[model samples]
Target: MSKGQITKARILHQAAELFNQQGYAGSSMSDVMDVTGLKKGGIYNHFKTKDELSLAAFDYAIATLAQHHRAVLRQHHHAADRLLGIMAVFSSFIDHPPVAGGCPLMNTAIEADDAHPALKARAQQAMTNLRKLLCHIVDTGIAKGELQPAVDSDVFATILISTIEGAIMISKLYDDPVHLERAIAHLTDYIDEYLRI
Candidate 1:
């Protein structure tokens, strides 16, 4: 990569961590400067505005998560196994999160509510993609007879995502891992008992 490209990449990495932890509204340009070691002109050279940087950082964060999910999903062929693996991915958020604060999707969704329309839309799209992925996995499982034929992919996917996200929120709130652990263990049993054919 060129020097400019490398600098831009570094800015995105640092900004992503900053935005994810402190949030877009909560974060200031000074924080970005501190994280990236870049002055205003340096940052503005790459991103025209803070809004632009926020959107880019969110996209970068989502891509990082997608990469991790793809790697784990590739290892499991069956739908149940894939779902379990996905859960394991979320579980890793406790100690080894892809970003700093918490689940970017959840964090963004909560913070980017009414005022930040662009960021809110991006968060919604990211969440839609996740739900679609889970639904696709369920569909594949049913087709392969790994999962029950009667399952409603939408409902199943919603349950899994909501439960996992909620657990993440609780875990982060109390700075405790037990809620996340129990949630994952329960989901595992839910998969084995209800999802498997």
Candidate 2:
């Protein structure tokens, strides 16, 4: 990569970590500059405004998370195991998070609401993608007779996504991982019920 590209990537990485640790409102360009050790002009060279950096950081975090998902899926072939592997990915996140800022979607969603329409839409799309991943696995299971065909893939996907997001929120607020574990257990059981049918 070019030197300029490397620096911009560094800036984005630092900014994403900060934004994940703190909400968008809590993060500042100066904070990013501080961690990045880049001058105002240097940071602005890649991103015109802190808002631009924030958007870039949000996208960076989501992309990183998606990469992890791909790795987990490749490691586990069974749909339920893949789903559980996803759970493991999130569960391990509580203990050893890739980015220090926390879940970008949860952080951004809680902060943005309707104010940042563009960011809110992006975050919603991330959530939708997550659901689709889960739904795809479950649908595959049904097709293979490993899961019951009577199950509603979309509803299941919705519940799994909601539970995961909600659990992350609770985990953050309570400073405990049990909320996340509960969500995973329920998700596993939800799948188990299908397997038994």
- Report the C-alpha lDDT of model 2 over 1-197, residue by residue, as the tens digit: 99999999998888888888877788777888799998899999999888888889999999988888999999988777887788777876687776775677778887889988878888988888888888899899888777777888788777777788799889988999899989888878876665534
Backbone collision tally, model 1: 0
* Clash pairs for candidate 2: 20-101, 21-101
Number of clashes in every candidate structure? 0, 2
* lDDT per residue as tens, model 1, 83-135: 99989989999899998877899999999999899999999999999999999
Give me the candidate number with maximum lDDT. 1
Candidate 1, after superposition: displacement of residue 79 in Å? 0.7
User: What is the TM-score of each predicted model, taking all chains together?
Assistant: 0.98, 0.93
